[model samples]
Target: MLPPFRPGTHLVFFALLLTLPSQALAVIDRDALDTAVVDAGELSRTHTLLVAVEGETVIDRGWRGHATDETANIKSLSKTLISALVGLAIERDIIEGVDQPVVELLGDRVPSDIDPQVNDITVGHLLSMQSGLQRTSGSNYAGWVASPNWVEDALTRPMVGEPGERMRYSTGNSHLLSAALTEASGRSTLALMRDWLGEPLGITIPAWTRDPQGIYFGGNEMGLTPQALLRIAELYRQQGKHDGEQLLTAEWIERSWAPRTRSVFNQDLYGYGWFRTELDDTTVHYGWGYGGQLLFVVPERNMTIVMTSDPTPPSNGSAYLEQVKAVVERMIAATVP
Candidate 1:
C-alpha cells in the first residue's frame, strides 16, 4: 500500500501557493492512487507509472517486470529536452532569441539551392515544428535518416508551407535545431545537456542515437529513466528552478507553455516542445513521446507525473495513449477536494 499524500511537507508547494492564490492543495487519497497504479498495470503496453503530488512521490510502480530506474528510449520526448537546451542557449547568449533566423546559425550547412523561405524560418518556428519543411517524420522518416547529410537534406526538402504559418509535426525541424545548437555552441548537444541540465538536475543522461553527421538525433531516440523524466517535470512545475537555483528561467517556462500551435492529430495546443490540454477540467501541460512515454505537470495541484511504455510499438490512434491519459485522470481526480 502507498502512503497517504501529505500536502505541506515540501517547501516548494508552499512557495507556489504564495503566487497562486486561486489554487488550494488537496490531500490525495492513497487508496485511490494505489488503485489507479494497479489499474495502470493492466494496460499491456505500459511499463511504469510515477506520480508526485505537492512535490512528494506518492506512487512509483513498474509492471511487466520493468523497473522504474531502467533507462528507456523517450522517443520524441527528446524534443522537449532539446527545447530546454534551446532555452538555455538563448539565456546564455549562445544563440540569439527565438526570433533569430535559423540559417544564420546553420551557416554553410544551409543548402545553396534551398527555398528562400528557409531563410525566414526562425528558431521559434523550429521549436514549435512550424518550419514549413516537408516532414521528415512518419512515412518520410526512414528516408531522411538514411540520407548522406541530415542537416543539408532537411534544409533542402521542399517547403510545404510558409514558416511559422502552421504546425507541421516534423522531426526535421528539431534536427535542424540540434545542428544549429551544435554549430553555435561549438559543442555537441550531448555535452551541452550534460553541463546544463544533467549536472544541475543530478540525473544520468545516457547518449542516444545520432545521425550520419554524428549530431545527436534531435527529436527522437533519446533514452532516460522514468525518475529522470520526473525530475524534469518537477523542474518545470517549480517554474525552471531546481534545488533553489534557477536552472532555466521562469520566462522560458512561460514561453514554452504558451500555446504556439495546435496538433492536427489530437487538437492539443503545442507550445515549443510541450503540449497543452485539460485533464479532468484542470489545465495540464505535458511532454508526450512516441509509444506512450509521458511527462505531465499540473500546476494547480503542484503535481508531476511520468509514464513510460514499450517504445517499439506505435501508440498514435491506437487508443493506448488515451488509456495512459485515463490513468493520469484518475490521479488528478484523487486530488480534488
Candidate 2:
C-alpha cells in the first residue's frame, strides 16, 4: 500500500517533489512516471489514470482491460456534479440562492414533526454538510436509503448539531438537495444534468440509482468516464471555463473551492462538494468517491487528474484511498521545468 501521511507533516522531500521549477510547462519523466503508476496499481486496485497539464493530456492509461472511454461508477464524486447543478439552478433562478431554506424547498416531504431547527437548515447548509441533521452516511446509509421516502427520512432526522456549524458529510444532505432541485425546477436531476452539464461539457452521464420517491441518488452511484471526469477537473482548473465557454460563473467556482469547514474523517477542509488538501506542497482540491474514485484539480500546477478504482471492494477502511493520494503525490512530483 502507499505510505501513510502524518496529519501535520508536509511531503516536500521526495527527490522529484522539488525538481520542477516555478514554470508552467515542465517536462515530466514519462518512463519514470509510468513505472510509478504501475507500482501504485499494485498497491491499490486502480483501474484508470488520466492526467492533463496545461490543457494537454500527458498520461492516459486504463488497467486490467478497462477502457478509458467506458464509464465507471463514480460513486460520490457525483456530489460534485450535483453541486454544480445547484449552482446553475440558482443562476437560472430556479430557486433562491444558497441561503434559501431547504425545508421550504422540500415542502411536504418535510415531516410535520420536524425539530424547529430544521427550518434553520438552508441550501448552503446542505451543500456544506452542515445541515445539523443526523448524517445518513456511514452506518446510517443503509437505513436512510431503505426508508419509504428518502426526503422525508432525511428531513425528519433529529438535529444532532446546530445548522450551518460543523461538517457532517452526509449523502442524505445531497439527496435532499436533489429533491430540492426537482421541486424548484420541476425536472429530474438527471435531465437537468444532461442539459445543463452533459450537453455543455460534451460528457456522457448515464442514469444512476434513484430513490423510492424518484429523486436521483444525489451523491452516490453515478457513472462517468475517466475522460469525462478529467474534463470536469479541467473545467475547475480553468476556473469554470471550457473551450472558451463559460459554463459556470467564476464566483461560483471560487465559492465551491473555498473551504467552508473541515471533514472529521480526514480532517481535510471541505467546500460545497469538494475536499481541499495538500499533495506534497501544492494545494489540491478534489472530489473523492467511495472505492478510490477521485478527481483532483491542482490550480498552481495547471494539472487536472482523474483516477478510478474498482467500486466493488470496500475503500473506507482499506488502504485504497491512502494509496491513491500517494500515487497523486508522485504524479505531481514528476513535473519538471
TM-scores for every predicted model: 0.92, 0.90
Candidate 1 displacement at residue 160 in angstroms: 1.0
lDDT of 1: 0.88
Candidate 1 local lDDT, 1-337, one digit each (tens) = 2245467532222222434556555566667777788888888788898888767787888988888899989999899999999999999998889999999998878888999988999999999999999999989999999999999999999999999888999999999999999999999999999999999999999888888889988999998999999999999999998877999999999999999999987788999999998988999999988888899999988889999988885565537777888888888877753
Q: Cα deviation of 69 in candidate 2 (Å)? A: 0.9
Best by TM-score: 1
Root-mean-square deviation of candidate 2: 7.3
List residue ranges in candidate 2 displaced over 4 A.
1-24, 316-318
Q: Local error of candidate 1 at 163, Å?
A: 0.7
Give candidate 2's TM-score: 0.90
Clashing pairs in 2: none
- For model 2, residues 1-337, the per-residue Cα lDDT tens digits are 2256556543321222222373344556566677677876675568888988777787888887787799899988899998899999988998789999987788777788889999999999999999999999999998998899988888888899999899998999999999999988889999999998899999988999999888999999998899999988988888788778889888998899899999888888999999999986989999989888899998887778898888875675325666788888888877643
Deviation of model 1 at 187, angstroms: 0.2
lDDT of each: 0.88, 0.85
Best-performing candidate as measured by lDDT: 1
